[model samples]
Target: MTLLAFLGVALLVVLAGSRVAFYGDALAEKRGWGRTWVGLILVAATTSLPELITGSSAAFQGLVDIAVGDVLGSTLFNLFILSLLDAVSGRVPLLGRLHPGHALALGFSLLFLALQGAALWWGGPLLGPVSWYAPAAFFLYLLAARLTFLYEKRRSLGQEERLARLYEHLEAAQVVRGYLLWGGLVVAGASFLPSLAERLAEETGLGAGFVGTAFVGAVTSLPEVVVTLSAARLGAFDLAAGNLLGSNTLLC
Candidate 1:
């Protein structure tokens, strides 16, 4: 029953997640924000709902290790999904077509990881009630977002008029509504996953850390996997790659 329920929820998430990718692409076109920007900020945040909810719940319950493991594991799992996307992308290569601005995002992700490692090694908070690294990471994320936005803006110059026509048949309001509606469904379905994961972990007799890292993390990242593939299939490769890379950075 547990396994069946897990699979069922996963299926729903996958279906909703695919819709999210299409709507996200539409939103990007309607807004002329570029696929990379939309994927990084919008789609990534929406798909990351599971990790956010699960980690917060675990942290509230004082399961610090589970929370931390879930974040770190989800980040790793998201990166793994990128490799999967590459493999399935065929002859042209998915990474080959990505915008160079993504390298900036990757650099920030690495910096965030290193900060996390330093925090772990220190074994104590450098700031009141939270590690200094937490705020530092947040600051760096803001900076990275700003820089990437500018970079994408410059690269997308004179292209907005062309991009806008891509979704001319649909109203901007309609696209936004569809994106939010599917995104909300994705979030709703994903929110229940953490409890289901915990139950399955108990039934399987797995340790908390292992279950959190492997089972919970992978389950939570199902949205990313489905959404990325959907974007790739739609020929929105930038959106696909941005979703994965941005998701890792967001989780970290």
Candidate 2:
């Protein structure tokens, strides 16, 4: 029953999450936003909702290790999705097709990962109860976003115009509505994951860290897997790559 419940909720996340990328693409087209930027900030955030909600739930339940493991494991899984994207893309190299701006996102992800590792090693409260790295990660993420925005803006002029519009029929309002609706569904489905994961860990007699990293993390990352593969299939390599790399940075 536990495994079945987990798979069912995961399926819900996948269905709702897949629509999020399309809506996000449409919203970007309507707003003249860069696809990479949209993939990074908008689509990636929606797809990563499971990780955020599950981690928060785990933390609130005093499963601190699970929370940390989920974040780290999710980030790792997001990166692995890139290889899957490459496999499905065919002929052309996936990395070769991506925008140069993705390097910036990759660097930030590494920095964030390093920071997380250091925090875990140096454990303790910096701001009363909050870890010192929390504020640092938040500020660094802001800085990464700022730089990415500027980079995308500079290169996006002629670049975006060449891509075909998949959602030309949808109005801006409609796109926003669809994105919000699906995003809410993703949130609803993800909220149940942590408790299910905890129960699974107990029943299976697996260590919390192992269950969190392997089982919980993989389930939470289903959205990313779906979004990246869908984007790749649509010939939106930048969006595909951005979603994976951006998700890693965001998980930090």
Candidate 3:
């Protein structure tokens, strides 16, 4: 296929992936989860699912260069997402709240990169935290999720819950079913994403890292980019901006 054709396919993947993530968030919301919970955990994880799947697949396929490229691409693209959020929100100061989940995620993201570098220097495929790191990170992620959920629940129950008056074009049942269905789709779609990326990178001769960061990264981040834009258009400013900041934390 032509480079243009490959680009088109990648774009389509991002669009589909974005919708899938929105479905997941909508499902969580329909289940009585507040916006923060939906944005932070549900939407955030689902949105980033593309990256994880692609990276793991590349590594498994012995496309280590592709794997590294995709991670770097995801990081760059995720930052672009953050910059868009900043421009849209006009400096709402997401970091000022000192949210524990954000803090933890930021810390882990840095540690993830730093340790991975150290591992490479020492001739390892992976890095620190021993054999227990993934599980430990998972545990911490869960705890942070619980705390965020509680915070949102309490916030909505109080005077802090204020809608941006931007609700539009929603289906209750469809959204409700989204959680499980979208999650499954992410697993399946992500499975294909990296291979697609690998082919595209090799075909274009653009180098694995750059292509992965721009193409794969943008493709995986499709959800947040679209959602944030939609939120801005619909006047759900907080949700739009929140999704950006929240997604960035997860990406990191």
List, in order, the clash count of every candidate structure: 0, 0, 1
The best-first sequence of candidates by TM-score reads 1, 2, 3
Candidate 2, residue 152: the lDDT equals 77
Error of 2 at 127 (Å): 2.3
Segments of candidate 3 deviating more than 4 angstroms: 2-8, 14-29, 61-69, 90-130, 157-171, 178-193, 207-219, 237-252
* Tens-place lDDT digits, model 1, residues 190-232: 8888778878887888735654457766778878889999998
TM-scores of all predicted structures: 0.90, 0.86, 0.65
Candidate 1 lDDT at 172 equals 90
After superposition, the stretches of candidate 1 with alpha carbons farther than 4 Å from their true spots are 1-4, 123-125, 156-162, 201-213
TM for candidate 2 is 0.86
Tens-place lDDT digits, model 3, residues 40-122: 66666665666777677778998988677766667666556655654555456534422344444445456555655555566
The candidate that wins on TM-score is 1
Cα lDDT, all candidates? 0.83, 0.79, 0.56
Clashes (candidate 2): 0
